[model samples]
Target: MDEDTPRLLADTNPLPETIDARLAQQLTFLIEIDRLKTVLRQSPLAAADRRENDAEHSWHLGLMVAILAEYADENVDIGHTIELVLIHDLVEIYAGDTPLYDAGKGLDQREREAAAAGTLFGLLPADQAARFRALWDEFEARQTPEARFAKAVDRLQPLLLNWMARGGTWRTPGVTADDIRARKAVIGDASAALWAAGQELIDEGERRGWSRPGSASIT
Candidate 1:
């Protein structure tokens, strides 16, 4: 099923005690995550009227894992990397989407998202919640190869979208090449080839006068 589609809730019809507990909890968690589709991101959809949502972003990142896994500096478990990207943005449902260039907007981002992760993942069964939360934390820590690759793709996706839209988000008044580089440093750390690809896009944006040099923050 598409990750964004809402599943039938177990509570919609009263369940007998015989219903499997794990299955019921999993279904509930799935239904809740469907809210991710409503959490619109700052990045606009390419050639579309609307913005991309957390669910679509996660799905795209999952596809990137399959397509770009070869570029990772160290061998990574594709399945684990997919899992990490799939849930990385679930917290955005509660914390809300923070634009890549809007550094001042999410001043308490870590604390807010950490609490959001706890609540969202906690909806799953005990073991599954713990495991999924661990994956989210791993992605945040960026220590393991899987986490690093996942983060690289996470950064790469927005850059691709902005380039496609001819500087969609990058056109924000104060956004600059330096802001892109600062936010996208992880791409180089995990995959030099992918980083080069991203830089090529940025260079083209600059050449076309779609992106300009400026500081993201004045203070």
Candidate 2:
């Protein structure tokens, strides 16, 4: 070896310990998702006056996936769909929830959600980041069968809560039947079965006097 080579080696420092890329990626998913437990300032639970936290919402949807998988159309991939459901609400950790009756608020909804998606999903390592973002994007785009079904499950949650809680959080806002139906129609593309289930809930709400036939429950 040349004397210059020895000098160059002396000048260099040892590289920092490298982490296993795969393990790093896996651990990212295990990382405690932060800023994800804030209760929506305006949104409420079905039967209660208090607003539910994003973590509660996400967990509720995850349970729906386990219990309602058979209701999904096209032999849905339950595991991936559950992952999608779990992360879908993560953006709310940053952007906050926009209620359906809050007209004109959606103007910046896409931009805010996209930014939140980047920040939250980027917490994971490269490949896992890509995977998480793809799941979120698919739900936003409402394009794939899995995404469609995930979206359906997403919509079903608030409705079930509002209906069962007998004027839960949704009752206070005076949300209307039309508003609920329109927001939930996106689910029809994924599963007519789930949509039918939603319709049944609406009918039951009206029949039980939880809500009016057409008007919001509060009014």
Query: Which has the greatest lDDT?
Result: 1
lDDT tens digits, residue span 69-116, model 1: 999999999999999999899988777888777768768889978888
Clashing pairs in 2: 45-169, 46-168, 47-168
Superposed Cα deviation of residue 197, candidate 2 (Å) = 2.3
Task: Give the per-residue lDDT of model 2 (tens digit) for 89-191.
Answer: 8877667787765666767888988887777666577777898899899888877777888888888887777776774544545566655677778778877
Clashing residue pairs in candidate 1 are none
lDDT of 2 at 50: 80
Give candidates' CA RMSD values in order.
4.5, 10.2
Clashes of 2: 3
Q: How far does residue 80 in candidate 2 sit from its true spot (Å)?
A: 0.9
What are the runs in model 1 whose C-alpha is more than 4 Å off?
1-18, 215-219
